[model samples]
Target chain A: MQKNQSIEIGALLLEIGALLMSAGANTNRIRLTMRRIAKSYGYKAEYLITHRAIMLTLQNPNGDLAFNQVKQTYAQVPNFMMVSGISRLSWRIVDENLSVETVWQEIERLKLLPKYPRLIILATVALACAAFCRLGGGNFTEMLIVFLASFSGLFIKQELGKKKVNPYFGVFLASFITTMICGVIGIWYPFQHDNMAFVTSVLYLIPGIPLINSISDIMDGNSLNGIIRALNGVVISFAIASGLLIAILIFNAV
Target chain B: MDWIDFFEKWIWFGVAAIGFAILFNVPKRTLIPIFIMAALGGSVKLVLLHWGDSLVLGTLLGAVLIGFLSIYAAHFKHSPPFVFAIPAVIPMVPGSYAYYTMKGIIKLSNNSNTTDFVPLLNDTITNGFKTLFILMAIAIGVFAPMLLTRRDSAKQIKMPLLKQDKK
Candidate 1:
């Protein structure tokens, strides 16, 4: 019984970590990730992201009878706001009594998604380019061109939604799309030098993951962990910049 | 620069109010009231500046006051404080400033004719960060009161979970 409970707890932590990494709090990706994490813990966890705040409820097998008790318990956690959109992920661990090891394992499992790396890279590039375009007032035609490339990245991952394609290959295709689009924009666009617009719009893709995660880490009173997450955000931003720089250099050379 | 020029620039005050209201998803009913209030608030800053107050400080206070009033309106309707506060904040967002800074960098970089590209980018990003932080600080200040007043009641109310079936 204890072992089963431990496994469930591990699964819950894993889900929260994964949900946090996906950029944008209210997107389909975060929702899907949260659902998967909750299911792993065997608890009937549900969530809602409204204009005001993100709310969640967890129902253990004690049924609705114990729901109030669970709610009260969670209401006491001073740093609950730290979880924000990823609250479902964190709440599952708390409810199921999972350990750190279980959470770490699940975090590891998320890498299995195949296209994970590629998605990260592609998203970063697309965002950077979009920010640049918006800043430059690059015109509808320029935006349309950039959008075509970013959409290609999104399309590569779309099959993940359909389950017909492996996530790894999807990421690769997405990265290729990002590279192709950004490279073309750099060489062909008259306003190729405007990295700011590209970067700003790209900020949308910059994964609020780091921002929220760092904030959460601080709120949870774990400065080291929070700093690590903050650093991760910087690293991810650099990764995206590196990809954009490489694409631009290669495209310019050719 | 002249009165006509100055009057033209204030158009953004209205633009700011509307953009904030919509982005925060304010209900249609409250839009007009909030817009009027925001204009009033913006004008107050203008008046204060003419009287020799610091424009930035005056504007910051104006944003806070506007946020507080909007929250009060929300309170009157039994609406969530967060709901109203967001739109109230729209007028204060530094959208145009962020846009121009970013645009300058991209233009300079592409042309390769400017020695000041690096400085321009850094300055622009710094300004964007400062603006974002100020906005966030004001938001929290506005939101703090709501949390304190509603803490007990929020506990009693069972917020419906939208993704209930997912589990």
Candidate 2:
């Protein structure tokens, strides 16, 4: 194999490792995707992934080994767009036997694809919160209050997240603001179920996706990463409860 | 939960799933189908719960259906199974049960006058386990499909995973 070919393969493998990590792919799936991609290129690959980082080893020219470690800089948020995009790219690699240069360019394009607009996310989340309220059997009045609170809370979360705030702190702020809004509403108008508003307003903030992923990881025998992800979910739940507890104390609603 | 009100929740769960799909940045074209999958899972739960069944049973049944459906959706949408499976399982996350578990702990802490801790413990334990089991159900249900259909992924990648990934 040419020196240039080996270098390109190493770079491609590292970039894909980093992409899978940042895209919120679990450790097992990351290894699977990396292995498959490497094999398709007529190379061998191995990886050790934890919650915080990824260490990938690929066999290069002359049977030499190449190692790359990708440290996750940001928190993991599921972007199905990127997830699906990566999935398709791997398959395309197999189908076309594409050169490393073309595959790398495709990854760059996927990384640049814009996420859904911020306004759309906020509006939809608020409506989802109202849906939770209705699912909780709350009346229209309660659902409206939850809708407003969720809107403001998700807005704060999105803004603070962009400002590079710690993800946990963002969750805390969102839940606190949401529960506080419901608390104030409770003081103004006592409804049949004021507490449901408090519960459902922050329903949008639960780490459902991560929690499910964690369990899936464990079942796939990636227990270390799975346990870590589950612990992250527990911590997020605690942050939410702390915020809600503070609001409850302030309103003396408990 | 009467017939009318029970059916009403189907729409809400569908809407909630759309919010989740949006938040996750699923492709714009996949939103409507994701909503339907979520609502379908929720209705499965509703039917089971309507018969005075345990929430664990209902959630497990619902998740099983969602898990099976997510495979087809992933194939059709040209996305990974996790993308659809994760969001579809959202409507049955048992968030309220977990919240109640926490609230029960807080209530017990605040019980200066009340001597009865039994009910508090009961509330916390019952709800806490409900949350745990519901999560387990969702996990197992979603993964069962992937485990069974390893051949689906195996077809895409000709590499043999079992021989090398011993750990």
The TM-score leader among the candidates is 2
Give lDDT tens digits, candidate 1, residues B45-94: 66666776654555566666665565555444444333444444444444
Per-residue C-alpha lDDT of model 2 across residues A143-210, encoded as one tens digit per residue:
89998999999999989989999999999999999999888878887758648888889988888766
Off by over 4 Å in 1: A1-136, A156-180, A185-189, A192-197, A200-204, A249-254, B1-167
Q: Which candidate wins on lDDT?
A: 2
Which ten-residue region of model 1 chain A has the weakest summed lDDT?
A69-78
Query: What are the lDDT scores of the predictions, listed in order?
Result: 0.46, 0.80
Per-residue lDDT of A112 in model 1: 38
True-contact fraction in model 2 equals 0.85
| TM-score of each model, paired residue for residue | 0.39, 0.92
**Residue B60 error for model 1, in Å?**
9.9
Q: Tell me the interface RMSD of model 1, in angstroms.
A: 11.5
* Native-referenced TM-scores of chain A, all candidate models: 0.42, 0.93
> What's the C-alpha lDDT at position A248 in model 2?
79
Give each prediction's DockQ, rounded to 2 decimals: 0.08, 0.67
